[model samples]
Target: MISIATALLCTLVIRSVVSVRGDEECDASAAYSSSGGKICASERGDGYGSHDVIRGEDRMIPIWWNYDIDQLFEDHFDCGQIIYGYDDGHPDDDHDDDYVDGLDDQAVKEQHIKISDPVSETELEKLRYQWEILREKYVREVNIVPIFHEVKLDSATETTGVDGKGGFVDRPRTHGVSAIVVPTRIGDAGPTKGRGVFATAPITKGALVINLDNGSTGLFKVGHSWREFAVSLPREVACNFIEWSWVQTVPPSSVIDEDIRNGLSIFIAFDESNLMNSADWDDVEANVRCGFPPKHEGDDWGPCRFHYHATRDIAAGEELLLNYGDFEEISQQGWVDIGL
Candidate 1:
């Protein structure tokens, strides 16, 4: 039997030789143990033997690192496939199908996969920031303006006539009439006297008069005697009369009246008793006659007054003529002009 001391020395020598050989001859037939016995080659067992030192660099890596690498490859490189065990026969060989199956099996065995909890605060904040950016990029805001038209009557005509009794009249009269009156003078200075009247002649039967606000264009009735025209409010002075007031109301109505002999009759009305009492009829007449006051005040007439009369017999297609004063006065009159 070998002595204990000699056996110990031999063991040390064998260990040194194996270390120097590295892994080159681990499986070679010439490899020997300290006793000069051939080293026995053992097949790697079901991954649980003491003799099984993991074969490659994969074995040297931490389990977590290996798992991360596998996951990355699976998610980004492989087309839904997994690479499994490395081949001993061919170092470069890769096993796709088996690898994926192995990974799945390992995951199941270890219970490593599970649904995570709710999104963290950081993630939610990111989402909100993105939403605000989108809102600012697309949001918008706007103000709208309106349009109007002007109408005029031709003064160059022989139709002017005098009523046998007193006042002046126009010829070619019509049963129903409509007209727009403008101020005779317009400027930055005080009010002026020169006003003009535009008459829509040849009034048609069943014609309807339309009232519109400064913001909108008036719509005309079909087959109406007057040509459809746009009307605009005066630009210079604010006409409080045009402002819609709950106190000043007019019933929707129309009227047909004849000229009083040769004298033209015009009507005006007001809300305040004192204002109407202070107005001058003669002044109103002079303005209408000579085209002085362009726009008439509602107070110009007491309660209600006929400011102008038709000069001639008005036909169905003729538009009635009136001074601007008449228009403002009537607005405040609040009487619905259902033709008498």
Candidate 2:
């Protein structure tokens, strides 16, 4: 197993993949580029090879976005044969013969996958997360961003205290104690902008909001198929890990061994600190900054600890933002001189 500590030593390099919807490329300079990065379907073709399945007039939605597992599975049943990849070890075998093939309405189901009775909500969420990871990998390999339906804003209005005079707003719920989530105007324009970190109470300048020390469990997992590893874990374990982890689809060139470059890494931050969003360094609203704990004379081997602090005094409801400046440079230089 590649140690997360060793992986961290390899600086991060981020590669930009141009997003195209149909024939034209997404305009990076457009006003809506940063606003959730969505593009419209072109009248010519939607480009997913299944153009016949989806009309040009309809909004392009990723195949995995649907929540109904049975329907979703039926729609992309062929993917199951590819993803599951069941084989009986025949060198010259053509496995496609095992299943009946025809149009969706005409094909007869020949294979069955069993599901547990009374599927729990957590299990369903895990399935969704796993499905998303699989589809994301597929799309990246093909170099296209699947157009997704706009996420619906939370339907419930912000709750208020008994005073009824803009008394209170429900804070973002979390299992840890670093920061709380609050609504902010940082995303696509809709009924709600998006969720961001907020101070549950007053915080003084330079105060630490959260501390991350991943020496114990190395913050990264390097592999070719992280999805298989994730899904193979016990139900609850896989669910929690996937819910909190972020996948770096393309790894830095510093770690660019032929095999490693093709593979990806999964980063896990074992705290709510992972929720902190990015902002520009000069942005007045960028209140949070990441720092490292001071090294003592004898603590030469202490694991890298990431400390997040307030740049200025922050009010109870003010959003916390960090400037995630050139991560590739930071990773390329290694964490020893991370100035952010």
Candidate 3:
């Protein structure tokens, strides 16, 4: 059930276009409505299931997760299911030995290869090769699919002190900001102890902020046992674009604070860690010094830079910020050190 407070928070944050039940024109000035039909100037809900109403399909935006090369292998094979190769009656098919013992040993080795430790690069490449073959064989049998959800805007206007309408008027080309409304701190917020939103302009009350690319939906499971997903940007260039757009939109008053300006810097930091961790470096370099090191100077760095939205306008007392860069790191570091 959605609380009245949550509903009001949503209305004030997103600056949704007010729709009269049967009216064609949206009334921007009309009092915000609740699920119960009560017209109130302030944000309120009946504490029923209105939370869903305030944050439902109308507000949901779609994002995609392009499977990483390794993820593709784990998804199809390591999920407790066999995805490749089949049993051949002749056990010594690939070896010169044709005896029963040799054939049995080959079968055992093949089973180990199928259900052993983490998939190796060679194994992943082989899987990809096999997948391609299977894909061709069952092009019509395979289905392309998408996961959908009604995620709340990560940077809501109330949270950022921006009016929704003002954002549209000022930055027509950019989407507004939204806040991460998760029950618990996740991503960079969990580790850094602080969280914020991203935008191209000063966000306005009632405007919508799309959690595009690395914003929120970038989460993915590592393995069956691990529930937390690392924070990451789709590409390094996309990170620069988000950072650049934010830096371009700041007001002179807020730009002088180094801490605020650098706050967005953590986005890059978390992304870097995500990139490293995703490669499964720990196991690969178990015995070699050439692999990723245990610790580095950049590891403990904090995000102190602040970047403003290009054309968005903000009000006073908003939490002024960006999304947490990575969740695993944030959860490990605790929330306090993230912003400072």
Candidate 4:
């Protein structure tokens, strides 16, 4: 059941009008109206689940794990603040600014920016600054190895194959940011397969498109483990985890650490950063490319995050695509890349 605080949080959340809710039964409002069945169909090509289902269709983003509602409210960490607060940190701070001249701080909370305004630029800047400190405090392993994504089961034959379920990393600390509602995003687009992430503005090169820290309770970046992972989960929840939008498989021939070689399927759960799409090697050559920001100059690096930079210049209304593992390389190696 949704808590009173959670319900209040939703009233302040920001939302993209064109979020990738499919046409049939995937409406976000419907999520609130009904308990889940196998009604909402899947939209990806990765053959894992026959279809995906959202238990609360009204919930804006898919959550792989639950959050502590009481603590979130006690700390004044409203999930709605995530959606309603500063996104890309670009709204004006001046009271004379026409866009938000009249709306008091209390009134500036909505999924759409119509009646709302973001937190002050100072607050947003401070949040970004705090993120820098966290990255330095917890320097762990870089996790994009080619072996962790080892569990692959043939759905048609119902056959499971894995020499051993690979490494499973303990959940990381939460980042400061948890609100998924942002205005810097465009409506969803699908070129070859499922939905992809796009920019609402002309994104500059080396721009930090997204960041995930361990402290943000809404997001969880975990390693896949078949033996101890989601074994007893219901089909809808389990399969959705398997076809993780954030799970990127590093090529086999690419030499890397011995420990991280576990078919690198970094399982992450959250809203925007995790929901972006994957482009093949050539689909976005003239546009944005993904990179891992080194932990310096006030930037943190992690296995799950691959920041997208404009190869040349990405125009507004362009889809932001990350180059995923080469299918041929994974196929040639004869190892199926599974999320969990």
TM-score of each: 0.16, 0.32, 0.18, 0.34
Q: State model 2's lDDT.
A: 0.35
Error of 3 at 166 (Å): 49
* lDDT tens per residue, model 1, 221-334: 111100000001111000111111111222222354332211111121111100111013223322221111223444233211222323234353322333334334444332
- Per-residue CA lDDT of model 2 for 148-239, tens digit only, reads 21223343663311111212344221121222222222111111212245566788776766543322111333322333333333333334
Candidate 2 Cα errors over 4 Å, as ranges = 1-193, 214-218, 231-266, 281-285, 292-305, 326-340
Off by over 4 Å in 3: 1-116, 119-262, 266-340
Whose TM-score is higher: candidate 2's or candidate 4's? 4
Candidate 1 lDDT trough over 10 residues, lowest sum: 223-232
lDDT by residue for model 4 over 1-340, one digit each (tens)? 1122332332223233222333344454422212222233333222222223233434533222121222212111221223221223432321224434455674553322432232333333322322322222222222222211112232453321111121122222233343222235523353223234566777766555543333331211232232113322232223333233234453343355443423444434333444455565336553544455454676653343333444455677777666454212334232223312
TM-score of candidate 2 to 2 decimals: 0.32
Best by TM-score: 4
- Against the true structure, candidate 4 has what lDDT? 0.34
lDDT of each: 0.23, 0.35, 0.24, 0.34
Worst 10 residues of 2 by lDDT: 110-119
lDDT (0-100) at residue 284 of candidate 4? 52
Per-prediction tally of clashes: 39, 2, 58, 23
